[model samples]
Target chain A: MRVRTESILPYSLLAPTLIFITLLIVVPIFQAFLLAFQTADGEFTLTQFEKMIADTSFADALKFTFLLLIFIVPAQVVLALVMALLIHTRFKGHTFFLYIYALPLAISDLAAGIVWLAIFTERGFLNSGLFQLGLLERPFLFLSYQNLPALFSTLIIAESWRATAIVMVILLAGLQVIPRDYFEAADVFGANTLKRTLFVVLPLLRPSLQNALIIRTIFAFQTFAVVLALAGRVIPVLTGEAYNWYALNRNANIAAAYSTLVLIFTVIATVVYFRLLRTSTAEAGFD
Target chain B: MAGIQFQSIRKIFGKTLAANDVSLEIKDGEFMVLLGPSGCGKTTLLRCLAGLERVDGGRVLIGARDVTELAPRDRKIAMVFQSYAVFPHLTVFDNIAFGLQMQSRPRDEIKRRVEDGARLLELSDYLARYPAQLSGGQRQRVAVARAIVMQAAVLLMDEPLSNLDALLRLQMRAELKRLHQEIKATTIYVTHDQVEALSLGDRIAVMQNGRIVQCDAPMNIYDYPANKFVGGFIGTPPMNFLPGVVRVNEGKPIAAVGESHIAPSVALASALIEKNGQPILLGIRPENLALASAQHANTIRARVLVVEPLGSHKLLTVQVGAEISKVSVAPDQRVAPNDDVWLHFDPEKIRWMDAATGDAIHPG
Candidate 1:
């Protein structure tokens, strides 16, 4: 009787949280799916998806999103790993350094993009510093059409700087859970710094790395605010393109289709990431 | 195998001295145990030998190598931690093979060595299993296998069997002794358990307050402790210390504990000469005290406070004046709480110490 009541207590306690999640996540997701299949006349149709695929902006948006992911993912992972290692070393003022590194976590993505824009703008800090140093004859046009590489670099840097803290925190937590004895044992076994980091620390940190990868990849797919703050309507990303189609052009049907596509891409990316993690991590016996 | 030596090694953590000017020589292929209470610097000394801890002063040498400033990787030593410290992510085979792999030994050689260690430890079937999947004893065995496969000159084990259950600990203790005998490596084992130190070590070093109080064979330490601390630490039920007045009666020394007095043994009488009329502690082993029917010479009459029945022997706690001393008797001996008994001890088995300094006054 006690066991049965104990089992029921959890369900009763979790009922409120379950209801809240259903209202917040499940309701909106179901509405989005409903909207995706509905026509302008409120009739069920596949025409919106067909029209969405035929739009040239959709292809360009897809290409730009992939490019952003390609640039940001590796940079963010590497930076987060370095930051985690630095914090793990317990140097002087390490807490202060960690706080400084994690300060960007509280800043809005749009605000970070605007901050980067101030540096990368034609009349911004970079050009003024160069002019003061006499490195440039005049203010360099960093965000100009001729400098596409500079624009891409600025976008990648802004995203990486803003988002790497979450991964760093996760990796730090992973590092904290690894027993000090493991490191001492490694030391006893004659493992040097590089070998210890690569063989012991990396293998143990696999679970955190996998979780960080999946979360960052999903967030990368839906990246919008930074691109909008940096280039506004000049540069089109997937979410920005969808916003333009739905709110500016007044095409709810095609916008829903674009939203559905982003959702599909997110699911696919998450599945692929987890599948890769499952295979490699299982082979490594990381769990 | 290497003979280990610590030459005035000291470790200070901030203002506190964890290990202070500790110096000792451990003979090659000798199983020397550093036995002490917790936080008495036994582990610190072990870590110093392994180079895991940096000494604030003096040098540490293994077989003539001045490894005082060397990193642990350069020290050529293997340590089994109290936690066993098995790599959780690695299989037992991989965990055992870790040291060899880190050294970048040939793959076939690593495989053969790990397999050989596993077979020796009876962990051959569990090689593919991870540490979490194995029992505590299995994990501890894997830790030993890992250290053994290193073929290092010195094996530093810090309470390696402390985490196991009592039965498992006893079994593993025997296994460890056998393994040591087979390997014949210079092993420095650390434990607070006197029984373990006495049974397993060739020579036991009893430490207190960062200094070695005594370093000798276990039986010698038991029979003749250099100081009160070693005498108190090395015995089970602990050597009982009774405050008594020493006096010279007809030019013969006698220790007076409460109303009863006993003649001093020759070994104790000479040391008590300087301590005449001074308050001293009389050290007697519980096992040394025998129950008698009548008042034997050097016997005290007391009422039993408690009776603890061990399978082989019974422990009787008797109140002699203000002090209570425990006496061990055969389990077959009929003794009960509240029973009046006469406790007799041989003078030859008694140890005398200065109460002020807690140092052995007799056998000096």
Candidate 2:
């Protein structure tokens, strides 16, 4: 009886997590798929997806989403890696820098977008400063449809600033697990700072980079609030279109189709990252 | 190969002085071992030589070049760390070649040198394997190969064999000595294991409280420790210290330790006569303490408290007044716990330490 109970114990312990995932994630996703596939009178059809694809904003939304990802993901990763390296160096008062870098993490995406919006606004600090410094003749228009580069750059900068802290925190945790002796040994072996970072630090940090890339790419795919707050109707993203279809147009099926598209892209990106950044124990030489 | 010199080197951590005014000189191709307990700053001193830790004051010279402000990469020295520190991402071959590649040596040269080092360390077959795939000793050999492949004039090892099992440590110790003989690189090895220091070092520097207490050849250090700390630290089962007073008896000096009056050497007697009746410590090595028959000269009667029978020799913990002294006896000797025994000390082997200072009292 005791042996039987022990055999059943692990499954019982795992019961809550399985139930929670099924109800929260699996059930919602299934409902979303049902909504995306079904017609208004409950007949199964592909009309909703066809309608979403035919919508003029669909291609524009896809392009904008990819554009934001191309700009933001790499920028955030590079910036976060530099920040994590600085924190890992542990200079005096570095704890303060950690708090300062993570300060953006506490901000919501809407708030971060609004914060950057103030700078990009025509009469905002950036324009005012440029005007005061005689770099600009007046408060020039910085966030307008006439300047697509400026608009995309503003969104990229804002999203990178807001989300890079997440990647930095993950990278910092990874850096902490590396043994100090490796660096000391490198030093003794005549490895300069750059070589040490390239050979030792970066190679060991692969797993963390993989995780950060996958998570940040998924988040970048679904970027909505920041674009909504900053670009307003100018930038069309997948989530922005989904929100429009659900709330303003009152088209739940199309909204679900847009969301399903985002999920599909996210899965594709995750698969790419898994294949590209995969570290087998044989390669990494660590369990 | 270049000799290394540390001239009054000092290193201080945030609040603690890790290496306090340490000064030493190593001859070219000599194997110097720094032996100390934990936090004694042996590792810190080695790091200062490697330029891993900046000295707070004084100068460091490697073959007449003042390398005080130079970075570790500029120091032209290699070190094997206690944890091995082999790059897990690289195969053993690449790990050994990393330094040569960093120096921008020709690829063929790097390959040849790495292969030679791998062969020397008996790791030629394991070159293509990663660190995790190898056993602990093999991984450590990879680390050693990484250092030796550099062909640097100086090699520093900070407790390299400390991570291995006892038998493996012994095996590696012999291998390290053999490697040193073949290469004859000026090596500075740091460890807390006295046996490692005794067996490997041409000269052993024993450190305490972030300062070197004594530096001498292996046998000299074992036979004549400079202070109570060195004496106590350098031996297994430790040297027994008994507080006593120096007394002049029949124009010769004697040490009274716990109701037993033992004669001192002629040189030691002359030294103690000047400080007659002064309190002193009697330092006796366990191996030097012999079991005696009843009523022997310079003998103290003791009751055996515990007897540990080793294979060749037995360790007898015998009580002499309030102090218990360990005596190594022949294994065939009849002794057991609670047995009464007489222990004798050789006059020439007795060392007198100043009770207050713990420094050995040498004859004039």
By TM-score, who's the top model here? Answer: 2
Each prediction's TM-score versus the true structure = 0.95, 0.96
Give the per-residue lDDT digits (tens) of candidate 2, residues B10-72.
Answer: 899988888899999999999999999999999999989998888999899999899999999
Q: What are the per-candidate TM-scores when only chain A is compared?
A: 0.90, 0.92
Model 1 per-residue lDDT at A194 = 89
What are the per-residue Cα lDDT tens digits for candidate 1 across A1-287?
99999999999999999999999988987777777898657789888888888887777788888999988988898889989989998899999999998999999888888898898788898899999999999997867656777777777877888899988998898888888898889988989988999889888888888888888888788888888776665556788888889889898767878888889988998888778666344345554
Per-residue lDDT over B157-251 for candidate 1, one digit per residue giving the tens place of the 0 to 100 score = 99998999999999999999999999999999999999999999999999999999999999989987877888888888888888888888877
Error of 1 at A26 (Å): 2.6
Comparing to the true complex, what docking class would candidate 2 get?
medium
| Candidate 2 residue lDDT tens string, A1-287 | 99999999999999999999999999989889999999878899999999999999999999999999998999899899999999999999999999999999999999988998898899998999998999999777768988888888889988988899999999999899999988887777777888888888898888899999999999999898889988987889999999999999999899999999999999999999899887767766664
Stretches of model 2 off by over 4 angstroms after superposition: A1-24, A284-287
Docking model 1 quality class: acceptable
